[model samples]
Target chain A: MIIAVASGKGGTGKTTVAVNLARSLAGPVHLFDCDVEEPNANLFLHGAVERTDEVTLPVPAVDAAKCNGCNECGRLCQYHAIASFGSQALVFSELCHGCGGCMLVCPRGAITETPRRIGVLETARSGDITIVTGRIDVGVAFAPPLIRAVKGRIGSGVTAILDAPPGTSCPVIATVTGADAVILVTEPTPFGLHDLTLAVETVRELGVPFGVVVNRVGMGDGRVHAYCAKEGIPVLLDIPDDRRIAEAYSSGRLLVEALPEYRTLFTGLWQAVGELAAKKGRATEVAR
Target chain B: MKIACTTTGNGLQSPVDPRFGRAQRLIIVDTDTDAFTVVDNAAGAAAAQGAGIQAAEAVVRAGAVALISGHIGPKAFRALRASGVKMYTTDAPTVEEAVKRFKAGSLTEAKSADVNGHW
Candidate 1:
């Protein structure tokens, strides 16, 4: 089963939940940190990454010598990153979407695509679990490509747990899309509740089966639980405000390692996710 | 030269908001002659697929030589710059105030918005 762990707000223990769940879950597991911008799961897991791959994007390089300034490349580009008119063409690398439209429309074949290094994908093994992650280079505008690279490393027969980035944006979509189920981790505060609402809407729109995991549960108000109940979304697991868990997190330690008792809780969480996926299959069959 | 002032809503001299993608209106002003025309940007929302480029094209088609706004992203900036339109960035709260600042030569070219935060 492919289960995606996501959060609406940053620093809400989404990674903590994901890492621990992978550690506790039985059978072969692949833990993919799809949060390419800043992947922190490696920091907590003590393991050797066996493989790494570079992720690149195709960027247009204009050869100005052979080009007549037809401006067709510019007109064809939806991004407007290129402009060719009156014997001069300028290309902005930052705004280039790597669509290759400019090269396709270039009458002189002056635009050639060159690989621009955007990020790297790393794969590591920790006993039974295989962790694959993407790390985007600083100053790169896109994350979806890197996120896809990480997800592509999934091997067969492994229960994949994807740790998605925060918020309802492109990166988040790339991580959660096509997963069997999603576990949205959120706190109980107003900001958490507000962003969770947006995230709920996003996942619902995608028609994915999802449940809520309330982290730092006792610290904030009980409004998150209230909202979940009202919306008919199940609160799958609740990790209370514990000082030991906080310390373990700050020192780059998995919660299951620090607190072995939490392993059973995570195992139960995984079971619950499996149940949800089974229910989704039944519902889809009934609809069909 | 007619200039487009990025605005929060579709009206004459509306407040010049910072958000480019969510801006409700693209207020077109004749900087040279002091005439006004408001273009509704309700159809072209920000960060949506192809919306930023479309909005830039709409502004350029309106014959605006320049764009005045609080912040512009790399995508929108590239779209406008490719069309030979200059952009003046400022934190002015109102469109009228921004035009006044532009006329007085007080507004400076805006930079890309900070992408670090959870916006």
Candidate 2:
């Protein structure tokens, strides 16, 4: 089963829930950090990076010699990254989405795709748990491709927990698209509630089975719980505001490792996730 | 010489558009013929990135020899400069006035882009 931990707002404890769940789960489990923009799960994991791979995107390189002043590529480009200027086709690599449509439509065979380094994928192991992360090179805007690259390392037969980027944007969608279940981590604050509504809508639109894990629960209003109850959304787990937890997080310690007392909490959360996913699977099976 | 002025409409009385990349329309006028053609630049206005470059492409494709706008970005400047197109910054209210100033040599010559990209 693949469980993606996501949050609409930043600093809402997505990585916290994902890492702890991975540690608490029994049997073979892999952790894939799909937040290519700012991957921090490795900082709290007990592992040295064993393998490194470069991530690249295919950007177009135009040959002016073999070109007629055809404007097809520029017209077909959705991002407007390609522009045909007289005899030259100007391609801005940063703006390219790597769709390769520009090269395919070039009638003169003048457009060739060249690889540009956008990020790196690193793999590390902490005992039985394997951790993979995508780290985008600073100043690169394209992250969904790299996020997809990191998720490609998922091995079958092992539970994969994906730590998705914050918000319900393209990157988050890419991460949570195929998950068996999604855990939306949220605080109970007003901002968290507002963004959680958006995140919930995204997951609902993607047709994924999801439940809420309310962090810093005791500190805020009960509106989140009330909202969840009203919508009949499952509240999977509630982590209270604790200074010890904060200190553990600040010191880059995994919750399962730093506080053995909370192991049962996460382990129980996994059980809840299994039940939720199983229920959804049966529902889909029955419908089909 | 053909001159391109960023404008809100197709005619000479159209208001000068302040933005080069996101300009609504560009009026390419031939000083010799006193004739003009309109090129829609709204595609650049809606572009996610490299709007300036795309807008520059539009003017270049129109065979414009000079460009008049309130502001030009670095990428647009580089693209126009590569085509040897003269750029002038103008506060003229209308496309007609901008073209008149271009001929009178009163508009400031934009030797470099006056603003950063996405400005």
Candidate 3:
């Protein structure tokens, strides 16, 4: 079972819920931090580095010697990463999406793909739990490609928990696309409610089964709960506003580790997720 | 020598657009003959990414050796620089005024991108 923890707005406790859940779950559980822009799950789940891999994208390099300026590559390229103006083609590798469309359309066969390093992926082991983290190099504009690289490390038959990046953009979509169930983490504030609506729409559009985990529940208004109730969305867990939890988070401590009493709460969350996923799986099977 | 000025309208009297990559239109002027033609930049203006690069290519395609605009972004500057096109920053109100300033060497040559990428 794959469970992706996501939030539409930043600073909504996605990493908090994801790390704690990974710690509470029994058996083999792999946690993949798909937030390549700024991965922070390793700060809480420190482990021995087992493997490292560099992430790269294939960007085009043009050869001027064999070139006739046909302008076909420029017209075909939507991003305008490469263009020819009655002369040699100009290639801006940073703007390239690695689609290879230009190479295919190049009649002179002058364009060749070259690997450009974009980020790094690391696999670390914390006790029995495996943590895979991806961090994109600075000035790299996109994150979905790197996020996909992180998701590639998932081992089969292991319960996987993905810590997704914030916002309902391409990065978030890339993280949550294949999950069995997604945990939409949000606080009870107005901002949370607004972005939760967007996230709910995103998950619904993707036809994925999801539930809400209200973090810092006591501080904000009840509109989040009310919105969930009106939409028939399940509220799986409610973590109250507690200074001890904040302090634990500040010191890079997992909630289950810092406050052993809350282990049951997270364990129960896993149970609820399992039941919901199982039910949805059966429903999908029946539909198919 | 041909010069391209990012503009908001089609004619010489049109105000010079502050943006380089996402400018509304580009007015190319032949400094020798005083003849000018307007090139619509709707495609670059609506581009999701690399608008500056596309706009710079458009200017190069028009055979403009120099560009006059309010602010040039890094990517646009790189693209223009690769084509050996000089970029100039202008505070002139109209396209005609910008061209006059360019001809008189009153406009400041942009040694580097005045603004960061994605501006």
Candidate 4:
């Protein structure tokens, strides 16, 4: 089962939940930190990354010498990353979506695709868990491509847990899309409840099954609980606001390691997720 | 001088709202006359693929010699500069406020909004 752990707002302990959950799961599991922009799950786990691969995007490189600038390439380019006027063909590297549309339409074959390094994918293993993390290049604009690159390394049959980026944006969507189940982590605050609604909407729109995990549970009011109950969404787990958990997190330690008793809780969470997946499969089978 | 405003919708007051699809409509305001004209972004094709050059082309065709927006991404900023279109970055509450700031020469042009990272 591929379970995605996501939050609508940053700093809501999404990574903490993800790391502990993966560590506590029985048998072999894979953990993917799909938040390419600033992946922090590795910082907490400190797994020895075994391999690294560079992710590249196809960008048009204009060969000006052979080109009669009829602007056909530019006209065909939906991205307008390439423009030809008179004798010159200009390529704006930043605007290019690497769609290769310009290369396909270049009548003079003036435009050819060259790989532009955008990010790197790192893979590591710790006992039963394999961790895949993506780090975006220092000056890249897009994250979806890198997120996809990291996810592509996922091996089959391992229960993968994706630590998704914050917010209900494209990056979050890219990470959580098509997962077997999603765990929406949120605090009990008003902002948390509001953002959780947005995230719930996004996941629902994708037709994915999801449940809520309330982090720092006792710190704020019961707004999140109220909202979840009203929406008929399951409140899967609650990690109470504990000073020991805070210290563990600040020191870059997994909660299960700090409080070994909590391992059973994560195990229970895993069981719940398995049951949910099984139910989904049965429902789909019924439809067929 | 006709300055173009990048808007989220067809109105004269929206910022670069990401919620709106890439079909950017250019709001052209004649500085001297204070009259507004909305131009269907000629570069809508660029936005279909979320390209910056197409956005720049839309603003340029709308007769804007300069652009004022909340945030301009790197690709779009480069395209705007290449086309010799002046850009101003401001978190103006409304489109009219942005135009006013541009007219008063109080808005500052900014670097691109794309966060640099390894791809």
Best by lDDT: 3
Per-prediction DockQ comes to 0.13, 0.43, 0.52, 0.18
lDDT of 2 by residue, B30-88 (tens): 99887999999888988767889878988988989899999999888878886778899
Query: Candidate 1: where is the Cα deviation over 4 Å?
Result: A286-288, B1-119
- Model 4 lDDT, residue A278, Cα: 74
Candidate 4 Cα deviation (angstroms), residue A185: 0.3
Error of 3 at A93 (Å): 1.2
Q: What's chain A's TM-score in each predicted model?
A: 0.95, 0.97, 0.97, 0.96
- Residue A162, model 3, lDDT: 97
* lDDT digits (tens) for residues A98-132 of candidate 4: 88888888778888889989989999888788899
User: Which ranking of candidates, highest DockQ first?
Assistant: 3, 2, 4, 1
The sequence of per-residue lDDT tens digits that candidate 1 reaches over residues A1-288 is 789999889988899999999888766788999988889888888769898889988888888786776879868776656765334466766567788898888888898998888988898988888889899999788899888888888766568999999999899999999888999999999999998999999999888899999999889898999999999999999998999999999999889989887888898998889988887788779999
Q: How far out, in Å, is residue A244 in model 1?
A: 0.7
Q: Residue A116 in model 4: shift from native, Å?
A: 0.5
- Place model 3 in a CAPRI quality band: medium
lDDT of 3 by residue, A1-288 (tens): 999999998898999999999989777689999999989898999978899999999988889897787878989988778987556788878888899999999998999999999999999999778999999999998898899999988878779999999999899999999899999999999999999999999999988899999999899899999999999999999998999999999999999999998899898999889987897799888999
Maximum-TM-score candidate: 3
The local lDDT score (0 to 100) that residue B25 gets in candidate 1 is 79
